[model samples]
Target: MTHAQTQESNHLQRGLKVEQKKILDTLLQSVYRQEGWVFFVYGSGGIGKTYLWRALISKLRSENHIVLAVASSGIASLLLPGGRTTHSRFKIPFALNEYSCCNIDQGSDLAHLIEKASLIIWDEAPTAHRHAFEAVDRTFRDIMQLRHPTSMEKVFGGKVVVLGGDFGQILPVVKKVGRADVIDASISKSLTIWPHCTVFKLETNMRLLQRDGKLPAIAKEGEDEPMWINIPDDLLIKAREDSIDEMVESVYLDLLQEYTNPTYLQQRAILTSKYDMVDKINDHILKMIPGGEKVYKRADRVCPITKTGVNVEALCPTEFLNTLQLPGIPNRELKLKVGCP
Candidate 1:
């Protein structure tokens, strides 16, 4: 059986969801069957690219066809699942220089191995260099020693390459590939005679929820559609206020019985003016509250300490303490000695 057949078989056994099954069926029937075809699956993040890729690989492997899956990010994770980097899988050199050629070295086992491979699935293809892809294609043609039209006629020569990525995230670090970058480049425009590639956009976002209990509306096919949601400023401000109020109430309740002093209550009230102020005051309160004790003592437990020479000592065993430093005061030190060490 071919690798595609094997993958489909496995997917059937696993019993994927309706949407997932639809995606798989579309890929198998529409994309994989085509030779010399470049299938691009563009979707939002967390919409299940990795899951689909695994299913595809499983089906392809079951068909007894070679499947090479490569990822741009999470190299270790990909390797754990038995995949390789696109560059390594294609046997393309890292540095592109004047001397660099598309032809793979003769007698190289790696080149021969890939030449016999059935399919190559490149994840995060948005980050892949156009030159790198071209080089790989050239190398494949060279390895087989077949001329154009004839050499590219066979399945491997006519190999199916599936490119998957979310274009919304990061683009290629070395060379950009996608609609915007290609359209911007004059050279890319000149080289294109006929559009041979079939671009498929994944419309349904399986990640976020919409206001109407449906999936977030994503542009199935268009350049002008907005990818991100535009939240209103008023709504955002209201959410912030609500969240702050809840946090302040929770903290106040936790410290209610402990710090009974009116001054402490005033300080806590002042700290709630902003989130940053709350954090600063909380840190201060935590420091004042002795470790291992949930409650904080009243300020009456604190005893004023006067620093004498370099040595300073506590006069009373106070449970609560707050250190204060004042300028122009004798010894310039004011320590609220506490009972707890």
Candidate 2:
């Protein structure tokens, strides 16, 4: 381990939450015994899911143990000490299906790493397809078969695996599919993997507790018949014509003065479900910044196809394509200003 890792481990070890420590202890015990326990830790945002993961990763690595830390996405992987995307790490097939297995060959370095790993931490497991998990599990058993004769019968080749994420936030993305298909792609829906897995919940919102020293009522369960969550007056914006102005002002106070500060921008964000609402919020904030604005128009073009395939570009008009505001697709026009974060 490097000096930075040692320092981080030492720092994370301190001020551990009781629940976090308990989960860490249980996972560490499983690693020590070489028990291939499939565990999933579920928690909402600000509940210290990542915090617990860092602690577990640090604790294991401090003892000279090999930990394969991976996440479903690149952004998530950056949060871990030595994390990589599961696809990049395991060489999982792009077009995942029921019978797919990872591209890891037996006796390879990655196979050896899988064999010697004490713990495998997969963050954001809920966002990945069930096939991805199954593929890795299938590969693990194949590589570890040399050591454990009945590895095929075991989950993840008797290697301790810890999966963590918030299921409430997002499910697996089954493109152009209905809600049922998306749900079906989730790891929880896998009969093979879900049955043997142990699930843990982290209910405490550390961010909320840190702010007011009082846990939010929503965090508690089993209330009387009528449940009510009280939102503070300051947190609520009035329903008026200038409500957007009020919302932006509250979240981004002194926007003109702090527009250039990356830290200030990173600390604050306004989330809206609708694309138009996002544009409204962004436009409101952009107008506040004192600088010349630049407008970039979208150049709508269809993806290339083979000679036998139909020409989608000729069939779809550029004007109609520009108007399409679908999910994961950028808007028709992007407005930016100098000094805008």
Candidate 3:
């Protein structure tokens, strides 16, 4: 391997903790040696789920096992040639539909790909649809003919699938899949008694700063932290407005002292929107600045407004112009210049 690859492999191997080591050992023994293992490692966000999978893959590679790591986010980056979304991987549409065995052929390539892999690590799996999982399994079984008793019964059929993700972050957007969904699906397959299928929970917050007493306890199972402060809306709004004004004044003074030319002052004022409302306060600055020269030129401004409704269409100003809503906002579109003085 190249120097970069060697360094990355070494780094991944070195990052494995005690529990991660135990999990990796169990997975290697059960999934590698046995057939049809679907191992899941679930945890809360920022809890090192991806790190553990990377470490496992590195370890497996060191032992001469072929590994493929895939995720919903980095489909293009993770997939060889080009990564694909989870939906594309399973040959499912963005919208969920009824489960059908007919769609199995659509996922033939993925099935063949997985059949050749020794270990298939699917990260961010919680966002995958339940039907998508079933479709993938059925497709693989059909394509590889692994479901048949005549086909290499002792070879473990295909790749051992390892799924890792945080169920709490976000469930499947197309179709909801939770602990109950996993249980129901497993029971349906008559593989519930099989030891190869197991759920492993990883509990520990290694990402957050522990010095903050408000931080949630790093445990496998516990109650969430309670809210300590609650303020009324009126006071909150006033405080925010005061803070914005203070920030805007600071930016104005800084620009006056620092910039000698009008162009530089315009640029500085434009950058000051981080403190106050960009459109409202910036427009005032553009008009007030010397030379009657707007920070944004007339040609630089573009209108973005859309009309709605077929029969009773009405004009609605864009966000840049409309700051507050009175009541009963109508569906309409009104064109207005951006950076207008």
Candidate 4:
């Protein structure tokens, strides 16, 4: 571990939450007993999921147990100690189906790693396809042959696997698929995986608690309904002719507030469901940046390479690719720079 990594682990060691400690204790028990236990920790944003993961890793590593840390995104992976993307580590197939297994060669280094690993911690599991989880489980069952022949009957070859993520956020991406298909891709909906797994809920927003130091107490079960965070009534927008306009004004009271305090720009953002709306709002805001200009221009192309014996370029042309207006990807043009448009 690097100096920074050690510092981070040490930091997380202090001020642990009650729920976080409960999860850790259960995991530590599983690691000690060498039993097969699958856990899914469900929590929304600002619930201290990453904090718990870091502290878990720090504790597990100190005891000399091999832990495979993986995430759905690169940014999320960086938060853990020696974390890698699930697809890269597990060799999950690109075009996943219900019946798919990881491309892990028997007796390979990856297989060896899985065999030696005491636990597997998968973060942002909700954002990945259920098939990805199935693939890893299949691969583990195949590559890892424990003491008994029926060891394969155990989940993940008798290894403790913990998956953590928020279900409310963006789910598994199903390109050109319907809403039903997208929901089907989610791990929660998987009958094969979800049924056997034990789920633990973390409802307390630790981030909010850390900031405010207080939260509304929930009534006892069967006594009353659960407590929910109260949204400020002033922030709500009614269905009016100028609702959209009113929303924008309400969100940004001083439209050009960042003009004087340039650093404030980093703290604010505009979110929209559509790409066009994002682009329009961004351009509109950039235009206000005191003579802000789109001075940079660069041509983008999707040049394919030869894979195996086939030429990838023959299947798709660069011109046709340039016409695509895909989500999150700009169409055939490199736009914007830091503090510029």
Candidate 5:
């Protein structure tokens, strides 16, 4: 039996939740019937969205069908088998607009892959700019037209495309833009495909369910600061002189003992919104871990705009470059620990 069949067999042996089975059956039907249906799986984190995608992929690939799994983020793409970033797979341009299409020719190898794919699973759909999806749509229509003349009228070129993401979670990141612009860039807001796509919601939080916990209720409109949900008191670290120490202890308890353990390191993390706070937390954590830190410094020189005979280092000194905290750029000096990721 094929690898997909083996996986599907294992899945069957384990059994699926009722909702997952229903959705899997529906998706399989779409692929089998060649309905060219567009589906959106809406679910929050730890809601078995990835699980469903795996089941669907297994079932389709078991039948010797080509399944393409792509995600908006690199980390998310790693969750699925044979997965790649949407930008990498589609050759989407970094700077996107409504008129943008993938950098793919109709007779290209990538285009042929799209044409042969029985189902396309795009995870973390909301995290991407809508233009990216529209670009793929335009490209798919153009490419699949070779197979069928009517492919132009269909979504994703008569292919069953399943998009999964949580709208409640991260939306498309629009740097130096207002909240409105970020929202406007989301697939639901910017793409006309949302109207045509069938949306299925996974209500059950599998993680919470495993812990015998309940899913939090959705906030109603006009509620007092609906966006601001009060975190549990125990979860919050009270501000104090030793608050950083307290946070480090709480998050990375027994850090010294299990510092080298990848699982332990992977499971716990201290998240901060600001870079200053991040630096503070990281410094505190580093100090806690008993190890000699290796410092690596990068030599910085300003990119010469003109081929003028001028000393670049004299223009921007090493000390000044090291102090510069530009957005998306790493620090000039990096302090590493034995256990650091």
Candidate 6:
């Protein structure tokens, strides 16, 4: 048997939770029947959303159906099978506008790949701009309908697409814009696509607590009794005036002893309001990790003020742009460096 067959064989040995199995069954049915269904899996940081995606991918791929696994960020994409950033996989324009559509021609190789795709899975989708989704919708409608005239008026050209992410966590990114701007750019605010999306939410935190951090397991009195995990108050902060020490102590008190554990760094994180504070925490963590470090530096340069280039205007000279610092992005205007780092 081939690798796909082997993976399918392995999947048969495992089972899914009742809810997950239901969602998977529905999605699989849509692909098999060629139904134009759109779904949204919404959940907080954890809750087995990624786990379900993996199971779905394995099952679908095993059946010889093409699945496109994508994510809003490069890091999240690494978790999915044959995953790529949505922008990269779809050829979405970096500077998206209301009229934007993916640069995919009807008879092109990319178009063929899309035509063959049975399902599209996009994770951490809430972090992407609304225009990006619109661009994809427009592209899919134009392309899929060409392959099947019956899909001419469908939302996504009779394709089944699953998008997932936590809207409460990170809304779409709006550069140099305020909170209102970011809110306005969310997929939820989209007039075209969001209304057609069916939403699913995962509530339980499936990443069980570390042994020391976990609460005592309660005895189940009945089959109908609900299962829950209680977190200790000491591990939780009480007041508005934040105490980083309390959180650090609760989460990483054993960091020195558990330094060698590969997942130690990933399990423990310290979020701060300021970038400088992050720098300080990073330095402390590096020192704690038993290693000598080497630092590489970037060489930055400024182009000549000569108006020689095509449609060149020194919009706020390089000197003025370098001094401003913003929260998330560089406060200064990005410098035009001569070479790559």
The top-ranked prediction according to lDDT is 2
The local lDDT score (0 to 100) that residue 120 gets in candidate 2 is: 94
Candidate 1 per-residue lDDT, tens place, 155-206, comes to 2356667777766666555354765764433212322211444556665555
Compose the digit string of candidate 4's lDDT tens values, residues 92-126.
99988878999999888888888888889999999
Clashing pairs in 2: none
TM-score of 1: 0.51
Cα lDDT for residue 82, candidate 4: 94
Against the hidden true structure, what lDDT does model 5 obtain?
0.85
Q: Which residue segments of model 6 deviate by more than 4 Å?
A: 1-15, 176-178, 208-341
Write model 5 residue lDDT over 1-341, tens digit each, in one string.
47758877577636678888888889888889988989999998888998888877777677789999999999999989899999999999999888999899989888888888889999999999999989998989999999899999988778899999999889998899999899988999755578779999988888767543333555667875445444557558776874787778778889888988998988888877788788878877777778689999877778655478776767787778888877798877789987665
lDDT of each: 0.56, 0.87, 0.55, 0.78, 0.85, 0.77
TM-scores for all candidates: the values are 0.51, 0.72, 0.55, 0.64, 0.72, 0.65
| lDDT by residue for model 3 (236-320), tens | 3343543545555655675434445565565544344343354456545444444534122112112343363333223333443
The parts of candidate 3 lying over 4 Å away from their true place are 1-4, 30-34, 61-64, 73-84, 95-98, 101-110, 146-158, 174-196, 209-341
The 10 consecutive residues of candidate 1 with the worst lDDT sum are 185-194
**Residues forming the 10-long window of minimal summed lDDT in candidate 5:** 210-219
Give the winner by TM-score: 2 or 4. Answer: 2
TM-score of 4: 0.64
Off by over 4 Å in 1: 1-23, 29-34, 74-80, 97-103, 146-149, 152-156, 174-194, 209-341
Ranking 5 against 6 by lDDT, winner: 5
lDDT of 3: 0.55
Flag the better candidate by lDDT, 1 or 6.
6
